[model samples]
Target chain A: MTAKITVEPSQKRQQAKQLREQQLLILAQQILQQDGFAGLTMDRLTALSSVSKGTIYNHFCSKEDLFTALSVDSLQRQLQLFQRALQIPGHSREQVLALHLAYHRFSMTEPTLFLCLLTATTPAVVEKSSPARLALRQQLELQLAAICQQLITAAIAEGSLQLAAGQSVDALAFVQWAQAFGANALLKPTQQLGLFSQLQPQPTMLLGVNLLLDGLNWKPLSSDWDYHASWQRIMTILATEAPGADGQLN
Target chain B: MTAKITVEPSQKRQQAKQLREQQLLILAQQILQQDGFAGLTMDRLTALSSVSKGTIYNHFCSKEDLFTALSVDSLQRQLQLFQRALQIPGHSREQVLALHLAYHRFSMTEPTLFLCLLTATTPAVVEKSSPARLALRQQLELQLAAICQQLITAAIAEGSLQLAAGQSVDALAFVQWAQAFGANALLKPTQQLGLFSQLQPQPTMLLGVNLLLDGLNWKPLSSDWDYHASWQRIMTILATEAPGADGQLN
Candidate 1:
């Protein structure tokens, strides 16, 4: 009974610490959204939050550390979305497509935070961040990559996907990631610039991912299946399953 | 006689201005390479260059304008490489592959300058850059897209490529651009982080572009042809055709 009493208070304290850290991340994200990266100084964050300067410092050693923390948060959120995306009932191809949709939706909804992924990787941010935080970020990245690798491996196991002579699941997973990143990065700019003015009004991300999946010779090719319908269905399920997922970040 | 004399002096002045601008850009690139984006400033640029401050201002209204000018220069160089890539004796598929190889080579050789493409597009830089420079950047972007479109169209014309019901040359060209951009951006970072350590020693960029091209159903698919051989041949040809393409930027 005495041990339980001691453990309960320690657990409570741990939970409290986590709650405070999460609150700080929300405040930091709000500041970043309002005033670009340049404006997100420790001083400004200290002034805006109810927390004390020393406590905030304890949470993040430097501004770059804070940026890394935000990136870690952003990636955690992406992982959740990917997990939610995989819950949809379908082949590995559809699950992969669902992952792309989740990524695209996340980028669209949290554009500012989405950029943290790029900013955190930059030398300027990485050099200043604490080793512990950097390790956490790398671990998260590997976790995300693992999710992709799992899908690819599952597809191969089920015989729905076949690796060419020199292809490996790791390389193919990396390719999908690059394609998704490339497509999302260009999506808004392409629209604003009217670069594809003559193209149809469909989702370019869907088209790009479909083409990549088709190239991999994944089963239920776009020609064989109505991926357009699958795209809509997956989106609907995600919306219902994780309503206001982006809002949770705030 | 008066007309010839007046024209001669004006032409000479223009030539001198162009020479000074090129020299300033070289100096700016050096500063960027040495000190990174933060170390670059008008004062620093003026201190390093032989040109007067007034002349520098005449060429670039702001530092962002200078970055845009650099991006314009980078794109122009890429266009030259693309044109040279097309000069190789091959089918449209091989030519498209050559374009990817040229892009990969450029990214590897002139990584700092290659980054100018992303830096110039940020809102911070775009808002500060001169309208004329921004317009030129847009024009260069279109010209690059046009090159990709022409290859896709030629492939279709030769019946070596086919588009789905909703696929258009414009969309496919944009996908290729996104794939190249995405793959290049991640390449060095992926290598440094050892993200795909288990993968073979092969160039992942080649694998990525091949997968994307295969997805498009371009002729001489990876299965049907030894694209690895073609990739090597293309690199050799580009190395010879442009002995120091990146050095030209410097």
Candidate 2:
């Protein structure tokens, strides 16, 4: 019996580990969907996943670690979907409009996951999670920056629009991205029951994106930059100067 | 002790009640600012407030009640400050611009509070504290509606813009307000870093608001009505038909 038990060990551990990961992930989703964040517990996860108690500890050290893994996977899928929404400029504005649609679609499709990531994103949660949390934020921002860069650069080259001096086009992306977050977080539920269905984020997206474009537009003084370019001039100075802000340029 | 208490009891109950309420309110804020939502305990409220356990219960039946009153006060103050940002839009464009700045300013100043009221506006919390939470969201929408209404109303009156035959000015307000919520909540963090100082929402506000204005510009051939709008429209409709989706809209 002792010899047979020893023989059952090595390969079973690897196979069990793989199965455990899949089960934990499924358990994590069920916990999120059924109980919300506050309701999650290690005992619950083990029971729901039908995995052994010691096996879980061998895999994940804590509930937060397990949830974090689940969250990262969820975010990756979201970013992949979001990438499709970001059309290069030659594409019709309908394609541009689709980007905003993509955001809401993600939020609706993954409300529980969305809640986990975004709700966990509060400074309160982030401070403790530290490097992981910060990295997640930067990751999302980078994707946003890439999409925005493509759109603005294409728009400028296509001559459909122009950007002003010193605007990263990346910064504007951050703004639009943030606005999209807000729309998902605040807009839909605030509306008078189905109002978001009647209206979409096109206008909001256009307003934010177009405004950044208007400022960056070396289009012409005749267009009446109405925005008072002093702000733009400041940004341009900061970007190109490369100053340490301690008066040294790096 | 009983005989001594009986001598002053009934006559001082009203005064005692007010004092206990004040103490409870202070304790609730202490819990919020220090411990956050999770750490707020009834025993903690009683201890921190320096009021007796029974006294706190006498004024606020539960810890949640104390939180409700505290939230109402904070939210009301926030809206008051935010609305001041929307006062008297100097131009059709200014109306939208002012709204964005006002929103951004308020959010940056009071992010955690905004997160509490706007993001954390869930039903479990709202079912008990209906008036305060519901009023805040509705009030926000009303203000946003007013801004869009003012812009469209001004443009229509001046002949600078037209409304599609069946469209109402309120249509623009709905989208504008929703976007405002989005932009304010998401963008403030980066904007505060001054990384987005140049993108200054003014232009985005103008462009997006203008796009909606233009989209709804009464182009006779426009057939894009009578369809499901997008995203939160479903929630908005559900909210309307039931009026019980969540606590606050924004």
Off by over 4 Å in 2: A1-23, A35-42, A52-71, A85-94, A128-130, A165-168, A191-250, B1-42, B52-71, B86-89, B122-155, B158-161, B164-168, B188-250
lDDT of each: 0.83, 0.52
**What tens digits encode model 1's per-residue C-alpha lDDT throughout A1-250?**
5999999999999899889998999888888789876567788888988888999998888887888898899999999999889888998899998999999888888887787776675555566789998888778889999999999998999999998877888888888888888877776666666677665433678888988888889998888999999989998898787776454543
DockQ for every model, please: 0.44, 0.14
How well docked is model 2, in DockQ terms? 0.14
Scored by TM-score, the top model is 1
Expressed as tens digits, the lDDT of each residue in A1-250 for candidate 2 is: 5887776886698787767786687678777688666567788877776667788877765555565556565666566655544422224233333455566556766677766556454433433343553465556655655665676666668765554333346544654565567556654455532343455443443343333333343243213432223323333333343333122223
Candidate 1 residues lying further than 4 Å off, grouped into runs, are: A1-21, A35-46, A51-65, A198-202, A246-250, B1-15, B36-43, B51-58, B198-202, B246-250
lDDT of 2 by residue, B122-161 (tens): 4233444445445655565455455557766876787656
Instruction: Tell how far residue B118 is off in model 2, in angstroms.
Output: 3.9
